[model samples]
Target: MSRPHVATIKEMAKFHTDSRYLEHLHKISQDGDNDDPQSGDFGLGYDCPVVEGIYDYATAVGGATLTAPQCLLDKRGEVAIDWSGGWHHPYHPVVGTGDLCGTGLGKGTSLWMTQGWVKVNLWMTQGWLGVDPMAGDPMCSFNMTPVRRAQCLQHALCHVLSCCVSVLSFHPVSLCWSY
Candidate 1:
């Protein structure tokens, strides 16, 4: 059987109206607040840890001794944990509108960065690298303005280059692709 394209609002509206769709909507709504670190993002949050755990478990079942924390790096760049789950809200020892900066990474101070806020952080963290998204840096991805998105994407792409410097020798004719 052929699989259908990804679902979208327009496509769903064209389908036969039925309670089945309504049921799915209801399921999503009920599970929406699951960003609660306590609840584990309605179970999707287990993806990282479970993948790591299984990979090692297969080799040993009980023979693998690696702890889940030591084995996996979640979006936060650390061991997967309930608290580290990106909530996109809640100020972590800092002031901001939401949690997890513009990059969607958790650590590095979680919070939503307004446009004006972005400008500020850029100014402050100019000398320092990796300022918190809440720092109001224009270069920081946390800033939600369209202009900042470009700037943030630029900075992120540049960082990507630096990160791959070691591997650059492997692929002499590298090509960059973006969406």
Candidate 2:
């Protein structure tokens, strides 16, 4: 598949204040190494590939948020999709130093989501139904037994699918699903 349009560091910095985290993220992008120790301690372990495309993912979402408003305003039927963009947990005014605490710094998925939600709400208020299929809460059962963990994931997936189907059944618009 073709790559989505990614946002630049300058564009992303507008939503954040910590220059240090942003610098580190920039380095990661330049180096293309998610396990870069210089990325501080918030690295997503050694086996996860989530960190590899984190910057691009964030950028894609940011791009979507930036243009979604205009798209909806110009033409009420415009459909914008950013499949890799939906972090949903990170917050703003990140509080940390050398190593980001909480949900880690530069993970502005939540920031993008917040902005996107506002635009989406605008669309919905204007009688448009925006279908965002971002299901399966990642923090289901991190400490459960192996078998139980699998069950929890399965259950979460089912719940997410059910919710998506229910929403689709009601509102028929652009469908964006993120697994």
Candidate 3:
């Protein structure tokens, strides 16, 4: 089947509060950058569009609810995967609106304001499977060779697929692994 159309910036803003934050995101999506690490406008590299796609997919699958845990419970047999997620940060509406010279200003400090919040736990609470083939290995270190890291991820993903087959018990499944 054809993939669903990705969401626009306007659609994503609906899931968030804080007009300032929304404006920052809109600028990143449109003008390409606003220079604040704590704001969504900071990152608009070539991969920004891809990141937007991932967010759109997650929201479309009903993963943005405030009560995601309860929602999962209500749909016991259904399965959803958000492979590109797991950044584990909260959405702060007023993050970049305060004093410009404040301590830790512009250093991505606001990014941590929502750490460990409910939204960050969506995957864990909703029964999403996490597989780390590099578990117990340091292949993810920046000093590690790119080839080594790629190999590790590939092995891990293969292992994940095998585990899914066994755990799924012959049930049909749909998976999206966005990067």
Model 2 residue 7 distance off true place after TM-score fit, in angstroms: 1.6
lDDT of each: 0.29, 0.41, 0.34
TM-score of 3: 0.32
Report the lDDT tens digits of candidate 1 across residue range 1-179: 11112334443333324435334333444565434343343233453222323322222311111122223322222222211112222223333323334433343443333443454333111111122342244335453433443355356333221111111111111211111
Please give the range of 10 consecutive residues that has the lowest summed lDDT in model 2: 163-172
Model 1 earns a TM-score of 0.19
The order by descending TM-score is 2, 3, 1
**Whose TM-score is higher: candidate 2's or candidate 3's?**
2
Candidate 2 achieves a global lDDT of 0.41
Off by over 4 Å in 1: 1-45, 51-111, 116-152, 155-179
Which of candidates 1 and 3 reaches a greater TM-score?
3
The estimated TM-scores of all candidates read: 0.19, 0.42, 0.32
lDDT of 3 by residue, 107-162 (tens): 33332323423223323222222222223322222443334544543443432212
Name the lDDT value of residue 117 in candidate 1.
45
